[model samples]
Structure formats: structure tokens, C-alpha cells
Target: MIKGAITGLGKMGISHAAILGAHPEVEMVAVCDASSLVLNAFNKFSSVKTYTDFEKMVESEKPEFVVIATPTKYHYPMVKYALERGVHVFCEKPFTLTASQGEELTELANQKGLVNQVGFHNHFIGTFRELKRLLSQNVLGEVFHFSGESYGPVVTKEKGGTWRSNPEEGGGCLYDYASHVINLIQEIIGRPEKIDGALLKSFYSKGVEDAVYSLLRLDNGLSGTLLVNWSDETYRKMSTSLTVQGKNGKIICDATEVKIYLKKAVPSEKLEKGWTIKYITDLALPVGFYLRGEEYSAQIDYFVDCISNGRKSEYNTFEQAAYTDKVIEMIVNHSKTN
Candidate 1:
């Protein structure tokens, strides 16, 4: 069995720990968190060794892989700690506070020949996979432009000086919320070559931005734009959707479904071609202990598979996350300058 440890006991961290503990091929060797309460709570359900110090646990547990689910600022050091000790790492997104640190960790992961992943799990959802498949089949036929929106109620009121509202610690909706949508944008159209009319606005947060807007020119000929608003109370929950329009068809996606409409129907027997649709229900993927979706288990399964084979992930790699960071920086810089 592959040995693994998890650090941090936040919502996402707890979810990861549960999935790790349940994984048939993995032994949840240890867990680390700064809080005694967190440790005690986790220990109640798990008999795994627990430590308040991350390096202490790393030394004793000697985990084959480590999942870093702490806040954005802690990502670089924790990932560095695991990589330096020759451990594969799966880290939550916004890879680092800055593009430079992202580049450094990505390089270190590569040099160590370690499997590295960032927690951009939306792509693992089956609806997106179907959309990507259709895109590859030339269903879109020379895609011309795309636009996306990531909206939520995260910062609608006073945050009371949390790390997420502080810019220095990678706090803000840009990193915590927009990163997922930006990663999706890159997956659809690749990295943006130019950012135009960029705007980052702060609402309830101290100095951090709660909303972002910008137009983009991709490295390819495709054009794109994004609007990420986390302070909007209108959103009941988090919603991220992208609409890709092309010569022959258009693909639109929200959290759980993809809708495609073809101007000229493809000569396929299965698809109606006018508006073929796919839903999360269509995948019928098995869910584990988590209520979020199967994406977490799917991602974890993929990570363990990569570790077993001594390989890397094609999606959500450190390099790809770093690219997303670079784009984020561009937006930040643009917002600052203009």
C-alpha cells in the first residue's frame, strides 16, 4: 500500500483526509495540523499518528506522498518540504503567492522526478471531460472566442481579518475563488497572451479584491474574457461557467452540465448536433464519503495511480498551475497599473 499523510484540517483538508483514509491502495499514515482540537477531532475517527509539526510528521511517517491543503501562503514551503524529501505532492491551488515561487516549486518537483498536482479539480468533473472530448472532435470547428464567470457569496460581508482577506498571504477572492475559473479558461483556450481593461475591485475585504474583470487574447488566435465576483450575494453557492463559441458550434458549461449547440449538425448517428447535452448525472461516477462530488476521489485516485507508476498528471500539474499563477499576476499587475 502507498503511504500518505495530510496536513491542515480545514474543510478541504478534512475531505482529503477522509478520502485518503478510505482509499484501498493508500495507508493514511499520519496527519498534521496546528490545532490540538483539529488533531483530537481527526484522531477520534482515525487511529493514524498525528503531529502538530509538519516536518516532524514527515520525518517519522516517511510518506510516499503528501497532500498540502493549508492556505495559499503555506503552499510553497510545505510543498518544498515534501519535494526536498523526495515525496510526491498534491497541493491545493493558487500554487503559490507569486509566480516566482510557483516556478521554483514546479522546477523542484520536476528535478526530483516527483508527481506534483494542484487542486484544480473542476476539470476532473465528467461534464468538462465530455466538453473537452467534443472540442477535440472538431465539434466546435475553429473556436473563435470564449468567456467565463466565477461567482459566489464568499465575501459578501465582513471577513474579520481572515487570511483570505489579506493580500500578503495570498488572501482574496482572486486566489481562492478565481483561480479555479482561470484554470478552466487556460484548459479551454490555453494561456492568455494579453490582458486588456483589467479591473480588480475590493468590497467587504480589507485590501483584497472581491471581483475581477478582464478581456484576454490567448496565445492562440482565440479571444477570451472573465468576470469573477465572490462578493455577490445573488449566488446561492459557487458557480463557474464558460461559453466557447466557434465557427460550427458552441459549448457552454456551468457547475454540473455542458450544453452544446451546432449551427450545422455533424453527421453523427448518436448526437442530434443541434444541441447535444451532457450532465454530471450522465457520468454516474461513484461517490465516497464526501458530498461535494466524485471529483475529489477521482483526483486522488489519479494521483495514487501516478505514484504507483512513477509518473505525473497530464492535468493539474505544477507547471500548469504556475501558468495559471502567471496569468493571475498579469491580471493583478494590470489592475494595479490601469
Candidate 2:
């Protein structure tokens, strides 16, 4: 069985650890956290070895791979360490502080032939998955543009001191919230050929942007806009919406379903084409324990399958993330110039 370890014990860390511990074909071997309380609590529930230092944990456990849910600042060092040690790695995003680090990690992982994946779990979501399929089927005839947003209240007027509030650590809403939609945009239409415009602003906190707005032009002549807000009090939970306009009809995808609107009447096995909605039950992969989605579990399962088969994931790889990070670098650099 492949041996797995986890670094970090925060909410996301716990989620990764849970998946590792429960994965049918893998052995959860070790865990690491700087907090004594965190380690002590995890120790009580798990038989896996726990360590305060990641290097010590790696050396002692010699795991086949590790799932890193540490804060963004520690992402590079931990990933670098694991990759150099010939261990496969699945890391959370934003991949690193800058695109250069992403490039470095991408090169290293590719050279090592290690299965590397980034945690852009949204790609595994059913509605988006369906949206991709429909787009590929040319259901829209000729696509024109795509726009989207992801918003919630994780950071507001009352919340600012955490690591998420720090630009270098987590990069505010653009990195935390906008990254999801940006990655989805790449998946659906491919990366933007050119970024037309951008607006990054901090409405609630001085250190980080609570809102991000950008206009992009895709290679296929599609122009799009994005607005991601993390300080919005209106949302009960994070809501994501993507609308695509085409020559014949339109496609709209949300968290639960994908809706299609055709200008002319057309009939398919399941869809009447003029207007039809498809929910996620049959489209998404099944899960034993779902927290917001089966995407997390699906992502873990995909990684394990890749490890077991000695192949690479077609989605959410370090190379894909590095490409996205290059776009991020361009945006940030352009923001500075303008």
C-alpha cells in the first residue's frame, strides 16, 4: 500500500488527513503540525506518527507521498522538500507566492516523474464537468464569451487579522476566491490570450483585496469578465455562477446544475434544448462523506488512482497551476504598472 502523510492540521489539513486516513488502498502514516494542541488532539484519534517538524516527519516516516495543506507561505519549501525526496505530492492552492516558484516546482516535479496535483477541486464539480462536456459537443454552435464569479463572507469587516488577510501569505480574495473561477475559465475555454483589464481593491481591509474584477480575452475570440468578492455579507454560502453566450444559445452553470437555453428548438435524449437544466446527482462522482462537495474526495481518489497506476492526472496538475499562476503574475504586474 502507498504510504501517505499530511502536513498541517487546520480545517483543510484535517479534511485531507481524513481522506488519507480513510482511503481504502493507502496507509496514513504520519502527520505534522507546529501546534502542540493540534498534534495532541490528532494523536488521540489516530495511530499515525505525529511530528512538530516536517523534516523530521519526512525523514522518519519516509512516506511515498504527502498531502500538503499548510499555509501558502510554506507551500514552496514543503513541496520542494517532498519532490526532491522522490515523493509524489498533492498541494493546496494558490500554488505559491509567485509564478517563479510555481515554475520551479513544476520543472522539478516533471523531472522527477512524480504525480503532482494542485487543489483546484472545482474542476471535479459535476455542473462544471457537464458544462465542459456540453461545450465540447458544440451545443452552443459558436461560443462568444464566458463570465463568472465566486463570492462569500469568509472575510468581512469583523475579520482581518488571520493569515488570509496577509497579501504575501494568502493574497486575499483574488488568490483565495478568484483563483477557483480563473482555473475554471481555463478549463472551459482555455487560458486567456490576452487580459484586457483588471481591478483589484480592498474594501473591507487595508492589507488584502476583498473584491477582484478582471476582463479577459480567450484564444477562441471569447472575451469575459470576472467579479469575485469575499467580503459580501449577502451570501449564505459561497455561490459560483458562469454564463456563456454563443451564436445559437447560452449555457449557465452554478453550484448544483447547468442550464441550457437554445434559440431554436432542438431535442436530445434528456434535454429539449430550448431550455433544460441538469442537476449534479448523476453527473458528479459519488462520495461517502461530503463537505460542501464530493470534489474533495474525488480529488483524493483521483490522486491515489494516479499513484497506483503510475500515471499523471489530466486535471489540476502542478503544470496547469503554474500556467494559471503565470496569468496571476501578469495580472499582478499589470496592476502595478497601471
* RMSD in order of candidates: 1.6, 1.5
Against the true structure, candidate 1 reaches a TM-score of 0.96
What lDDT is obtained when candidate 2 is compared to the true structure? Answer: 0.86
The TM-score measured for candidate 2 stands at: 0.96
Candidate 2, residues 216-293, lDDT tens digits: the string is 887677899988898887998788888998887999998788889988655553556488888887788886656657
- 282: Cα error in model 2, Å: 2.3
lDDT of 1 by residue, 300-327 (tens): 8889999999776797999999999998
Best by lDDT: 1
